[model samples]
Every structure is written in C-alpha cells, then in structure tokens.
Target: MKYMYWLLIFIPITLVARFGLQLNDGLVFLFCCFGIVPLAAVLGDSTEQISLYTGPKIGGFLNATMGNVPELLICGFAVQAGMYSLVLASLAGSILGNILLVMGMSIFIGGLKYKFLPFNKNITHNNFTLLGFAAFSIVVPFFFKYSGGGGITEHSLSNFSLALAVIMIVLYLLGLIFSLITHRDIFDDEDEDEDGEKEAPEWSFKKSLSVMIGATVCVAVMSEILVHTVEGAAEQFGLGEAFIGIILIPLLGNVAEHASAIMMAVKGKLNISIEIAVGSSMQIAMFVTPLMVILSALLGNTMEYVYTPMELLGIIISIVIAATVFMDHKVNWLEGAELIAAYIILGGAFLVFGIG
Candidate 1:
C-alpha cells in the first residue's frame, strides 16, 4: 500500500512532467521539481538517519552530501547540459534558502506554538563553526568576481573557481577535524525534557547508508531530463538562467526539508525541529556547493561560483541573522517571527530581481 501510494502519486507527476515536455516545457520543468525533489528528499532523509546514528562527523558528512540531492542532480545535469551559470547560482541560492528560509520559518512557527524550545546547544555551536567557514568560503569566488572576468568562461576563471573548490574542500576537512577530534561530545543527545527524558528515534544507519548510495544513482537518472526540461522552460519562458537559479531551483530543492521542519514542530520536538532546520542549511552551504563544483569538474564542465551583488548581500544578511537568533540557548516566538520576516524580505527581493 505504501509503495502503491508512492507510485500512484509520484509516477504520474513525473510522467506528466516528462510527457508535458513535448508540449509546454516550462510546465514540465515545474512539475519535475514538484515531483522529483520530494522523492530525493525521502531518499536523503532516510540516508540522514544513518548518518546521524553513525556519529556527528559522519552525520554531518552524510547530510552534507545528500541534503541537496535534488539540487545536486539538477545542477549536475545543468552542468552536463552546459547551463553552468544556473548550476552555480542554484548552489548559492540553495545554501541561502536552507540556512535562512527553512530554519527561519521553522523557528517562527514552532516558537508560536510553544513559547520556548530547547536544542542541543553544543551541537549547534559546532555546526556554526562549520557555517563560519562556509560564509568565509565565499571570499575566493568574490575575489575572482571583482577581477575582470566573464563569469566562468573568463580567462583563467574556471581554474580559479576549481582552485577555490579545492580550498573549500581543505577547509571543510579541517572543520571536520575540529568537529570530530576537537569537540566530539557535541553530538551526544542530552535527554532534557522536563516531564521526563524522551528517547530519540533510532535511525536505520545501514538503510540510510544504502539509500545515500541509491540517491547518487537516481540523481544520474533524472539529471539529464531535468537539464533538458529546465533549458526548454527557460527559453520558452524568456527567463534568464540566473533567475531560475537564484529563486526557483533553491526553493524546490528545499521543499522536503521545509516539510520535515514543520512536521517536527507539530510533534513538539522543538530541538529536533530546529536541528533539522539549521543542520540541513549548514550542510547545503558548507558541503553541497563544493560537491557540485567537484562533480562538475569531473563531468568536464565548469561550475562557476559567481554571485550577483544582491545574492551576496542576501546571503550575508541571512547567515548573520540566523546565527544571532540561534546563538542564545533559548528560543522564543518573537525570534521565530523575526527569522521568518527576514526570510520574507529576502524572498521579496529575489522575485523582484529574478523577474527583472
């Protein structure tokens, strides 16, 4: 019955999309996101359970790789199809959306339901350490931006971008070292509810491992279709690739995460809710973007890391506000509202610029 339900729902959505590609490509592109992203999220989340159980570093690693499966798949296809800018902007947008929008909305709504929520502060702080470096990861790309270069194709540009990817990998490795070696205790779940300590869900670590590998496989399957559909949609809609990247793609990539955050909130697991929101975002930024670049390089395409001025501004503001709201040990309704509002402001700006 479960498999039947999934097949009935998801298969039609995908077929509607794949077939619709023959008629109206934009519609097909839209449905693919509406369809495929959720599927990948299911895969990614199942995989995440294994990662969480294996320990913090492994969990972080797993989430980092799989959290943005839809985005990664789309971007990889985009790269293969030669939509380099779209892939790059999508990476930037995914990070910002996951970190800022998903987390922000979850906090706001969850806090409104319950006045105060508790989370694993030590783990959050450890994640922040990675985020700090993630924010800094923007430096090199921005450096190349200020120089006279025409996005990825600019002379010596792809090399610089690739080099930056290498640097991010090294820094990420160091952060992992710091996370596991320097602060291993941060991952321990403290049973700390007033009524009594509740046991957390035990993840299917082996299942998650299998699914993680499976996600990589499915990604290869759908990417080609996604790339073709996106290009057709973009051309038909008269939308620029940049517009698609900075707005549509990221939001689509994160829909599953947004749903999970809300579900946790409804369940009254505020700490777990908040953890999913923030942890997922950190993974997107620190890990997903670099992986795309590496994969693009492997696929014989250049995934540039150029950010528009507004994109950079939005990212910086989102990270700062998100970090500030969560930095404290306590979370309240007001902070949640503020986070949501901040995201709204960013979203408004994106649609405005995206349509421009």
Candidate 2:
C-alpha cells in the first residue's frame, strides 16, 4: 500500500504543469489520470479504515457514500462544462464497470484459488433486485421519449426525469435503512464471525477521518485538472467523448475500489468482495445517477434521464449478464471469464462505433 503512494508524484507534476507552465493538454490529462489512481486508493483505504470503527452496517453505508467521490467530482465538472453526454456516459460506465469488470475480475481470480465460492443469497438477491429497478428507471425516460405521447415535450421529459430522480433517491435511502437497520444481519458478512467480537481498528478515528478527507480533497483537485483537459485529450487521441467517458473516466475513478474488491476475493472473502463490487454498482444506480440528475439541474446543465440507444443497450446487457452469473448462488472462474469477455466485447463495440 505504501508503494501506491508513489503515484502521488504525478499530482504535483499535474498541478505545476497546469498552473506553473502551459503544458500540453494531453500530457496534463495523462499525468492527472495516473495521479488520481493512488489518491483513489488512499481514499478507499481510509474509508475502509473508518468503517472498521463504524462497524459493518454504518461502515458499509460510509463506503457506499464515499466510494464514488472521484466519479461525482468528474461528472460534476463535466456538467459545469456542459458536457452532459459525457456525464451520462460516465454514469453508465461506472455501473457497467463495477458489475462486469471489477466483479468479474474478483470472481475470476478468487474462483481460480477457491474453485467455487458462495455468497449470501439473500443479500445478493436484494441487491440484484435494486440493480434491476435502477436500470428500469433509466429505461423509463427513454420509453417516454419514443412512445409518441403527443403531450411529452422537453419540459415534460425534464419533469419526468426530475420526479423519477427524487423517487430513486428515496428508494436508495430506504435501501440503506433496510440493509443497515432492519435486516443488517442478513447482509453483513462480519456477522459470520463466530466469536461476535469486533476487531480493533488499526488507525485512530481522527487519523482515518483525516486521511479520508485529505484523499478526497486531492481527488477533487485532480478531477478538475482531468476534466479540464478531457476535450483536448479526446481530440488529440481521436477518441470520441462518449468512448472516453464510458471507458477511460470510469476506469480511472474506480481503479482503487477495483483493486480492493480483487484483493478481498484473493483473500477468500467472496462475500465481502461481492458486497464491494455490487454495492458500488447499486450506489451508482440508486444514489449517484439520481444525484447527478438533481445536480445537473441545479448547475443549470439540466440533463434528462434519457440515454443514447447504445448506452441503454449496453447497460441492459451488462445487467443481464451479471444477473445470470449470480443466479445460481455460486460462482466459478468460467463465469468470471464470461463476464470479462462480455465487457471486452462491449468495449470493443463502443470503441469502434463511438456511441454516446
């Protein structure tokens, strides 16, 4: 973990280039991209450390809330810049990336070591249902758009999206209540400990809180630099904004959490790994996406819930593949491989077609 901090060097380099010298946008973007990885890792680590003190329920809630700080910052900046399509693409990508890429890698690597791993079916199913509902919410606005309802105008669509966003947020809070309060034991892996003794936190609460705050601040600064350079970088690389948003942004924002999930799986804690991956996706869907909708409106960049056809299709396919894999309550390396393969294929299609 100490070695990961070395990536922080890019932070100063990015700052100096952006402020001290007029560096190439591509180079600034590249440096900021690498720089954010360790910051995100530190952020995730600090959050987990904090969770150790909070216990599983509240800890899980903290993880869900803070896990996507980078994404939120990036998209917030994008929204301010009027890159609404980019913002939506990043949201979609985060959801797909977690459920398919991160979860797949975790399960694949863990399955190789464990042969087969079982997770808590009740928790998994509940999360799966929420994921499906979230996906359906996205689909709803699109349905209204093409349904030929003569009364549906831009204002009406925006209103529809606003209402749905509020509802999703309400559902998200209800989910937290359900998992963290009413039925926490069913969803909590820590409850499996036979001794029922909570482990002592390695860090002092102040230290954990300080690190989480510091890492988050650094990520926010880096994300601003990154978002500023995105347009130039996209043009320089000949990659469409949609492709960059869908693949590159989410990958950078999520690399730290991705590493944590894979590590948990490698340690034979499949339940924890699943929770990290699926819970992150659930957060993106239920919390992050709706939050973006409300934020965009407040920022005067009012983005509707409607997604491009390809983006919608990509999300639905990813959800279906993930649901299929987890349905049996058991997972093997083959299933993991399948998920990764699906992601790769979808990525290739996006790269080739540049769908927004």
Top model number, lDDT: 2
Report the CA-based lDDT of candidate 1 relative to the real structure: 0.66
- Report how far off residue 268 is in candidate 2 (Å): 2.1
The residue-by-residue lDDT of candidate 1 on 118-235, one tens digit each, is 7777767866777777777676567666874565455466677778777777776776676567765665555533446433545566766676676566555555566787777888
The pairs that clash in candidate 2 are none
Cα lDDT for residue 241, candidate 1: 68
RMSD to native, candidate 2: 1.8
Q: Candidate 1 — worst ten consecutive residues by lDDT sum? A: 1-10
Query: Candidate 1: TM-score?
Result: 0.81
lDDT at position 74, candidate 1: 81
lDDT of 2 by residue, 222-264 (tens): 9988999999999888998888999889998877678777876
TM-score between candidate 2 and the true structure? 0.95
Give candidate 2 misplaced runs (Cα > 4 Å).
Answer: 195-200
State TM-scores per candidate.
0.81, 0.95
